[model samples]
Target: MTLFKVAQLARTAAARGSRSYSSGMFTNAGYEASREHARGAVETWKKISLFVALPSVAIFSYVATKDELAHIHHLEHDPPKFVGYPYLHVRKRKFPYGDGEHTPFWNPLTNPDPEE
Candidate 1:
């Protein structure tokens, strides 16, 4: 339609969109209500985790491992010697630095020594 009518319509639309139901000023009542709700939720979740979830997990773990624990036994003999099979323990090239005999973080308990 006319430019004046279009401008008036746009102004009216913008005013309606900007209108708010709540007061623009901050209020202590709103802050207190939100804080109380958040505190109650935190306490409820803490109680559920402490009294319910933790104990349930502990009981489940114990029951599940009880049979395995009873049957567990250490090996009577030492581990088998590392037979020099090309495909099995393939060490293509030695390390660039250090003695290059064993890995940098080699643990005798877990990892077998190359010389063994």
Candidate 2:
């Protein structure tokens, strides 16, 4: 039989005090109204996410990168001078692998000085 009919039978049985099949729970009286409300909420949130949240995130991302992009452009045009100090770039003992001085992953363009 249908769930509602089963519940009704369980309620009737419980009222008679034969044995309580149902634990005093029943279906929501406003289930259809609640479901419609939930559907409306979902649609509203979807619109908000697509129109408001998406654009806000994209604009924030662009704004965040704008200054960093300008700084990168400036650095590319005029890089800071490399200073030569005794402690800096020191090689008191050679590394166990790969020419002992320069690392295998070292790039000449970035770190140009590899000892004269």
Candidate 3:
């Protein structure tokens, strides 16, 4: 679902909160009721987010892990389709400042994968 739809659902849930704030100090039952409502809303949002997030995470991991495994297995073939989003790696190259041809510009040992 869209973000606006999610926001609308959250707003609706918030509107359903039990008891209204009065000018006086909050009571124990009122606090309990408010907490309960908030907890319910949180639980609902958690389920929705998991449903949306888990599959995408699985797909991303599958594509990434498969590519890494392919490399380890001495397979020089290009990774399968969907392994990378289009133009995801299209960025300006950063060359070394000096003409130190002996030095590698980017060090994999020191530079962590941007994906991580």
Candidate 4:
């Protein structure tokens, strides 16, 4: 028989004061109550997931759009300087043959003293 028909029979038997009928009715009622609780829990979880997901999606979208916003606003930034060994040494060295050609290093004979 279908669950509904079984529950109906159990209820009728319980009303007649039969021990067997009482047990069946109580079991059916408990099952129905548990099912309701499970459904409510699932709904609660769905609401919680939506709350969590919406903010995460909004944050990700905002981060992704930052570059586009910067481009539209014509934002410019200088390139980062290299902090590693070779690049640091290269930057520190003054090019003797370049703009400052009169520096002592460029004319070794004029400043023969190495300390100079």
Which regions of candidate 4 are displaced past 4 Å? 1-26, 63-76, 86-116
TM-score of each: 0.46, 0.48, 0.35, 0.35
Candidate 2: list runs displaced more than 4 Å: 1-28, 84-116
Which scores greater on lDDT, model 1 or model 3? Answer: 1
Question: Candidate 1, residue 74: CA error in Å?
Answer: 3.5
lDDT of 3 by residue, 1-59 (tens): 99999999998888876445453326887788888999999999999789978888999
Greater-lDDT candidate between 1 and 4: 1
Worst 10 residues of 4 by lDDT: 107-116
lDDT of 3 at 90: 55
Using lDDT, give the best candidate's number. Answer: 2
Q: Rate the local accuracy (lDDT) of all candidates.
A: 0.73, 0.77, 0.66, 0.63
Candidate 4 local accuracy as lDDT?
Answer: 0.63
lDDT of 4 by residue, 1-116 (tens): 89999999989988787644445435878889888999999999898889988889998999889977775454334323334454422335555665642453543332232223
**RMSD of each candidate?**
5.4, 11.1, 16.9, 20.8
Q: Would you give me the overall lDDT of model 2?
A: 0.77
Which has the higher TM-score value, candidate number 3 or candidate number 4? 4
